[model samples]
Target chain A: MRLILRQRELVADAWRYAGEEAGADAPLIATLAELRTDPERHLARRGALGVRLTPVDRVEELATHLPRLALVACEFPGPGEGRGYSQGRLLRERYGFAGELRAVGAGVKQDLVFHLARCGFDALELAPGEDPAAAVRAWQRYEVGYQPGAAQVVLRRQRFFAATPPA
Target chain B: MYQYDELDQALVDARVAEFRDQTRRHLAGELSEEEFRPLRLRNGLYIQRHAPMLRIAIPYGLLSARQLHTLAAVARRYDRGYGHFTTRQNLQLNWPRLEDVPEILAQLATVQMHSIQTSGNCIRNVTADHLAGVAADEVDDPRPYCEIIRQWSSVHPEFTYLPRKFKIAVTGSPADRAASEVHDVGLHLVRDAQGQLGFTVLVGGGLGRMPIIGQVIREFLPVADLLSYLEAILRIYNRQGRRDNIHRARIKVLVKALGIERFRDLVEAEWQENRPHHVQLPQAEVERVRAFFRPQPYEILADLPAPAGNARLQAWYRYNTHAHKVPGYRAVFVSLKAHGEVPGDMSAEQMDALAEIARRYSFGLVRVTHTQNLLLADVRQRDLEALWRELEALRLATPNIGTLTDMIACPGLDFCSLANAGTLDVARQIQQRFDDLDYLYDLGEIEIKMSGCMNACGHHHVGHIGILGVDKHGEEWYQITLGGSASGVTALGEVIGPSVRKNEVAATIERIVEVYRGVRADGERFLDTVRRLGIKPFKEQAYAPHPAAA
Candidate 1:
């Protein structure tokens, strides 16, 4: 039942990379620095690896960088900080990077999964022994938005004023 | 009274939806407090000292019976069963909860009303003469132009976030009932030498910390260029108006600092650069808006009936009513500034009653005045008695309009979080002391204005006898000023002497009136006498220490 996530995986691999003598089969995860800066270093050489990035770390930077790297991870540093959500949007919309943008750290609340998904975060890392099924159900609460988003049924209004001349 | 076309309606509906979403996000913690603050303020929702206050726009003080009723409903349902009408010709509802604001705005939208641009550092509700259409001296109805400006300024992209709030007042009549000289941008609808209707544009006049009379920047701005010219002035202010200090942020302060000539040059340069791109006003559009406010059908009658035995009605008619342009019709004023009542207050029942009267006697139109009074225009001479009877029953037929008791006061210490002293109580005390209407009519046109602070929200500086409340050593003290006027040839009121304690204000006003009565030389109004004798005579009488009696 002890499934290794991004932050824990990165800490476990860093311990292994430093030649520690603990559990050898414990999965490894890459740090936010691995995703944000010098991604090739972690992508080219790793075992059971995951990447972690804070919301403040520019998401536009990952649009080009995420595709070359095999594994990518994103982190929400604290509650109510939304830079990560926008970073996820750039990753989904512009670059078309489909790899997992994992929601990690204390910022992973069940209520935010829908927003994270809208911003193209498909996978989430919760605290130890937390259920992901309940977290996934939180995204289905609101069915409509006046604004267009990643959710289906993106409504666009086109106004036709009789007085306006054709462009 | 311009009816919203589909475009206008769509715009308002979209804006309401947008604001609702913003409110939802703020409440649900999707938006931070800092991000939500400006959005709510732009929508006219303010977090006041007691509760959330919502200000509804009443563009140029014109409202239909239906609109007024909608306001009443909103007040009764969302607020504390009452609303306060402001000097800017808008209504403010106190005690609306933060969560209920979207619902309130939705209700307002149904009546073609929204609180947009009411509170922000943007172009505010345009005010005009309350008697625009019916006044005898008016050149044309200013409502059409006011409506045009209202649309142009509402949530304007370039000018919505200015250095400070801006106000524009328009006056079609030479009498200047709208107080054009005290607004940020004052437009006087005038006829040039060739008999063309255009605006004599004045800039930088305002009443806040530094009171000033606006200077004429353009002698005669062509009627067609009204919007373009206004855009020019706003652009100049937005780019150059001081933002570093809040006190010096107003256009009036900037105009003063740069000097009128320099400011005019700057605006003219801006006008030159931006004139070509502005949206031209079409004649059809003007006619379309004007059609909504066409003159009500008035009957031709020879004369007004002689004063009857109902002395109360006669007193009310003489003091509260004004001459109408139509031969037989009269412009009747309903005094909301009666003693002990808050200024510009009407209960839901009272609102319905007034609506009934407007439908019955005055072509279904009502006007809220800058002086916190209401008007029923185009009332026939024969229907005066019936109208008076109905109004009297509603407790609105107060005979003290433009008298000492009909005081133009702000929501002082009671409601306004910024006020330093209690103005409503002072107004009540003065009204109780000067209860005799016959004596008041004899006193003749004494305008008493009270503001709780130096910000001049009550426009105390323009009153005939101005009362400014100051917090002196943890107690309320009032300063008196004489000879200020907002009408035809505007002038700021002069302070007679030092500030007096709040308790002694009634005595001071009485003494000042006595001085005027004693010095008058046949057929002179209070303002005229004060103008003739200067402030010296009134000062000596007001400040003279009571003689020690033997």
Candidate 2:
């Protein structure tokens, strides 16, 4: 897996993540399973702790430990599943989790990149061999959006005020 | 017709660019077909049996002369020189290449048109009565509301993908010309005792393998609460509606599974929580939309001289012209279901000619009817003879607007990938067998809907004489249904008996008509007769094996 964090590739040696699942070489990072099962023990020793949440995981439950966490990852089970999107947005706009939020799943493809970012994922963990550069242009597909969410002001509200007079 | 403002133009143009890049990524192998299928379908590109069919949205069935010309140009440039008008008042090109779809969409965007949300799980095109603004019995024009929904549902973030496709239809008149009751959501524009306009919301009426009528969810919802209320229902359906099986994924199925009472309670809960802080649609916004649909500049004058007693013109006058709200104006229907031609199919040249006539006679506006016909909304009564003659030259003057010859049929095996039998040929055979105009006129207002399969795109379940094609051991056979209607009082037809061979289908319809002619009371319609007497009389002979059956 490769991470595009804050519009930059997450290159090795900047931060070595040691986990059998990630096979990463980071010096100190809590594995996803440890963070979920034995959170107190892992919280005692970790420098930077991150937990991966599936579509079923409650973001508010993870918010209980928001002070101890630096990153929270959400996974898309498949292309058809959109629950992860709502999870991501609530973590930012509702719960105010200002830490790094990453989207990790096989279904993370170029078509969903624009929407993924708008729904508030600061980092996108693409599957192996996927190009991070191809999706960099997708976030600018539209200068405007319809529904209210994490990124742009909803167009309806914008129009309502725009249609208002100079006063 | 509504004019596009800067916001609307920007939105459509931006969508075109976005879809173009999506298509490019798909072709470049960056996006897998499985990942790209829903995206393309939402843009109305369908891979048909032979080629890609692009369905262009005719929002609320309203089109201007310039847009019609653009459509004709699209037909000539990217496809064969013809387009099919569907029962939903949209247009479909049957033979556009997959690679040319992006250019086709860009061309459509120039006319303030694109195939956005025209297909797929998103709210499909919002349809309204063909005779909406000009109808004499209408309480309020429904197009403004339809436009509000079009903008709300277009590229709607959460609902772009759903369990199944959703449809909505609105009707302003008491006559129910939009077939609202058979849609996923039916909105009937009604006025309260206080004389304020509101809507009667009907949920979950649909036709497919499961044919059901929508139930009234609310008696009267204020026009301001429309968007918020719709969002509530959609949110519930999107989250809880069945996704395990595609067959049972429509909102109608969910509405049925949980009784309408339970569904209404759930929707009410969502609405109550979301209502106070919902999207604020002020009176200015409502009036802003309503202003666009105000009555066009029409002149008041005395009625014109009737095209004086010419029998053919008189027949055309009786069948084709409808009473308009204005004294000197009338609505004229151009039947695309002429004999020897495929129903709902119009050539590019014919479309161009209609555009010219729409400019000259009817204020440059055209409307597509749910019955798969076209209408000129504000035609002058004085121009009836001249327009009829012009249409006759185009072979569009088929004086069978509501008669048996004016059948509604899906593309069937001819173009649709899902069709099981050839419906266009069956429709042609029936038209040939029943070509007598006088006899058809006597039969009086029969709707014969045909579908190739149980998907019911042909709306076979609601026709007066519904013919459903079935595959019997690899042979084409059709089942006959009687007494269905899509009118003011909507009802589904009942299957008479066993299926009949394809060769006997037309003759069976003729025999059923004979039965209606024999026993019907004076001034009774075919559907009324079937309803009163039940299907036994028609069933006795309709299912009997004909000597010619293979």
Candidate 3:
């Protein structure tokens, strides 16, 4: 029954996170601790399995289990806490995580939408009181950036041509 | 100087539009103060004591005359009629309103400048040697690399929000004018054994409550791997650094906790594992950026003789001008530390006039030093006299570039909400006490850097004479440190004695100088004397019962 912005579209989330009662038809997103304890047990669940990663959770531990996973949710406790960004990047680029890379927790807001997307978060589950339409509009804040990111095509690639001669 | 391309302009324009929308939302009460604080801070807007302070980035200290004029206009039109040049080679407008910042930023974008990442927990402006291209003892210019780093760090997706604010400095010369060792990351341009250009990378050096010198992480990082190596290091810091406590969150604390060797190993491992995905510096891009820093054309001419002028002019020439690699040119320092005035405050009128003067003499460009002064790096020797006379008329020629009165001070309690004491008045008292130029010349090259708090915004840790302000029971007191030096054996000063009363700070300094004068060896500088004799004599003299007390 929760709503999230997935690939620039606001849609109802069918995945349930930890602490919530697992629905009969909903895919359960378990914590990294749960998945690490008995990977096969979680892997053999009724529906597709997802893993939620805290800031301190190592991405390399989940690499071998990435292919069987349906989603990877990186949690940000607050806005100033930024370890999730590195987690998102490592999951996609280092571990080749092709599943839905989702950003969750209290820190996900409109201000962080562009950065989260740039760091390879294909879906963003913002905190309470955040506007989804404004978060979608945040993607247009920058058409180009200087560094190559997870979705790398938006970077300004051409060599700098000065408008005036150098001194 | 590097000029902005169409792409650069577009990014800046987009940023202005985005900030405008963000500000509108915040004003309409949609965003709470806590939610909007980080967003505004990343754009260099700070809610200071009096008003919002906007810090504009001056990348590698280089500025075109036209850009300077725009800054003057911004100062004149938006806020106060003046701005403060900080120790990081950035300009801060002390009284800008939050509502007006968007419009101010839009105006600044017209001239290819923005205040992006000048504050907050993101990577701040990339700083470098002020005398980048024209210094006599240079390996290579550091500006191009600084620019490359600037672009890579600008709104970096992963590293935008970190444990704490980060600073990086690059220096090319052996003299280390950029103070790279005291930064979060210091990049030194050096040549490998086979004569290939690379960087000697240092990590975790910072000046705050706990000041620590940066440790060398890599002796020689190839030019091609600059961005990748940086990315690896940043990734390690962003992931492993302590975020539980804000005070213990700097990379320095992490480096200290894990030990430099362990930290370096982690960085190296991360770097190796992600080599393919790491951002690599392309040779073509390096060349493209380097082309913008090509040396200005110089005429074939011999060095001229000393100009016949008044004693003030001669003194100005001796103290305020520096040697240039080119024979006929000299790099001139426009002293912002004029006695009895605030250290780095410059009026809009002065900025506009300086822009015109720079256009006439120094190829329409200026450089702001980390010591909070301006420089015309390409002035001809033949033009020194005329330039000095004009500078004298404008009150910019103080003839006290390296003396005791030439201090580095933060805005302190007057403008900073976080300050514990007022530093500008202390600066004025010290200036008034040491009014004699002859006495200042005798005790040559004593750097007095003062900060109103432990934040160390004034870089008091690396000064030869560091003064830190502390509050005790609703009263101001100053703690003095000695023997710190930023260049040629960089060090942090040691505490000399107990805190002195606010009014007695200058007298305490006078006592320390007297001890130096009594005990110094022949031709030794103040720092040399302190290093040789240690702070024992200075401390004894500083704490001895005063005549008035007796």
Candidate 4:
């Protein structure tokens, strides 16, 4: 059995990925195409609704299904493709999707795990040949960041340059 | 020169430790070469043709005397005895062992320097006018804004992987010394009619396989809105830029394809979505960084007596000095393009000497210009002669700045793996042909730039007389371009005609200059002459049967 990482810990992912091993009671992960075509069918039968977001899919497409999506997973199409990071941010921040936001795709390397975590991915499906233990270790690479992300603090607003803003 | 506090220091130290472990894993075979490529590149380690090259950032071209000494030490301890100052105002150690890079980075951290974001498909070092604080033009200094941008862009998670590298250049003065208009984002710090600070932003300007002049995206953006607006631009580019072809990946192609109006609309929409809560600069934050760049404690000297120096000293003073905002001080330029030497290469001994010079003469501050020369930004007028004499002994007093001989060229076939032909030899040949100082001074402010290939690392497209080395079959061929400027009105040069053989490059340039001297109006610069007369005369003179070429 393969293991995935969640917040820098090697653990079993509750949400099944696109082609991963899942039990009969696992939530059916639907792509954006299927969700747009037949939303009711996907919402009708499952342990939980897991909608997958592609690099090119508009994050707004998943907005209407926010209440039903127990897991929203974003896929990286290519190595240099950065749309997934932004896609993850929108699903978590703009739409207020509080479900398990999972990051999947063979293109998500270990070096990008910290960024993926910062961009609001609670769980990451490691790329083929990438060690899950290394992914867990690599997620602690940066302690501070420039921009404010979903799970990270903004260093620009940190108390170094000046006093913090009023609460 | 923004001082780093504990948080900033901690962040850099953490990065150094991370890279060290990454190196250890790669060497131990735990991480594959494919997996380590981007990781090492983000830390400015490049596996070059011969060895690994490490590029260190020189933010806004400002450096302290102590930093200079540390750089000298790094050079002596590592690969070679010298380091190369690149056209982007960054330093490169062309021959570092891959295993020693982490240790090298640790050494750099002690001086508040790092190699972060110098390579890979990330935002590069923020460049500004070398004389940012000292330029005679009256305006706010641009370094503080550059520092803000630097801090905001450092290890930015979202922007780490883009289609291609992004660059930003800032200029405070209207004179446009920093080549702001030829960058990925050109920021002109301007004041409004109401005396409010703002920026005139330009997007999509770059030089590579395709050279372009940036278009104005925002005419006047309030200073506080800068970060949000920049994020919006980067987000749009990251989502929409081409990923299939590397050649068409730069933001310039996307901006051109979308049309400036539509691109502006997209960026505006994104900016609207991210504003009000996104990384906006607060008043206190801006003041914090600005205070570090406030004017140094300068003694008030109303005027200075005439310097008692020889004619040689007078010539050096005339060419190598720029007017300073302070009445009694001047900005002095040290020419790295001395005869028979590389344009931007400085030895360890020379670097140490420069450190000592800056400490004694210029308030212990030095700035590296985009043109690859060094600037002592706070030289007193009364010390000009004495400084010149000392510089003369050091062989740095080359009175050829802005003349025909002070040309900019890239690390062509000699040290670069991507180069198709040689640029240093071409630069040397041209320099030798115009070696006579009298003739070169007569030629006047001519900008000769060269690039080995279309990558345009040398900024050849913006030169008044540009030379491009092309690979014809296996031998090297040369192409000549004319009438380009990177100042207020940025433009790419036009090719004159057929490409010449390598041996004919010097003769071709000589003929072109002769024609300019012949038909030029009195006191006209080479660029002005080319623009006024057009490329017709140059093409005719260059291609006409030349006995000298034969």
Q: Which lDDT values do the candidates have, in the order given?
A: 0.75, 0.83, 0.89, 0.84
lDDT (Cα, tens digit) per residue for candidate 2, span B210-273: 9999999999988878887887788778767887898999999999999999999999997785
Off by over 4 Å in 3: A18-25, A152-167, B544-549
Model 1 clashes, total count: 4
TM-score of 1: 0.77
Any runs in candidate 2 off by more than 4 Å, and if so which?
A7-74, A85-102, A120-122, A127-129, A152-167, B275-277, B304-306, B544-550
Residues B1-550 of candidate 1: C-alpha lDDT, one tens digit per residue: 6888765666677678767877887899866676566567778887776887888888888888888888888788887777887787888888898888888888888889899888867788899999999887888899999988887776453455577889999999888899999999999999999999899999999886788899999999878788878877886776567766878988998899899999999889867754434546666767888898888766767667745888888887787788888887888998787667887777777887888889888888888899888899778887888889999898899888888777788888777778789898888778777877667887988898889998898899999999999998889899999998989778899988899988889888988999998998788999999999899999988964756741
Each candidate structure's TM-score, on Cα atoms with residue i matched to residue i, is 0.77, 0.91, 0.97, 0.96
What is each candidate's DockQ, to 2 decimals? 0.03, 0.22, 0.40, 0.45
Runs of candidate 4 exceeding 4 Å displacement: A17-25, A152-167, B305-309, B544-550
- Stretches off by above 4 angstroms in model 1 are A1-167, B544-550
Better of 1 and 2 by lDDT: 2
Number of the predicted model whose lDDT against the real structure is largest: 3
Candidate numbers sorted by lDDT from highest down: 3, 4, 2, 1
The CA lDDT at B123 in model 3 is: 91
RMSD each, Å? 10.3, 3.9, 3.4, 2.4
Question: For candidate 3, lDDT tens digit of each residue in B11-47?
Answer: 8898899889889989999888888898999999999
Per residue, candidate 4 scores C-alpha lDDT tens digits across B1-550 of 6889876788789899999988999999987887788889889888877888899999989999999999999999996888888889999999989989999999999999999999889899999999888887847899999999988888786788888999999999888888888899999989899989999999999988889999999999999888878988998998899878999999999999999999999999988876433666787889999999999888786656545557667778878888888888888999888888888888888889999999999989889988888999999898988899888888788988888778888888888888889988888888899988878878889988889999998899999988898999999998899988887577789999989998889889999999988998989988899989899999998965857878
> In candidate 3, what are the lDDT values of residues A44-65, reduced to their tens digit?
8779889999999988888888
Sort every candidate by TM-score, greatest first.
3, 4, 2, 1
Backbone clash count for every predicted candidate, in the order shown? 4, 3, 0, 0
Worst 10 residues of 3 chain B by lDDT: B273-282
Better of 1 and 4 by lDDT: 4
Instruction: Give the alpha carbon lDDT tens digit for every residue of A14-34 in model 1.
Output: 322223353544334556664
Tens digits of per-residue lDDT, candidate 2, A17-128, equal 4444432323234446556787777677535667778765666677778777777778865666666765675567546677777777887766667677766776777765
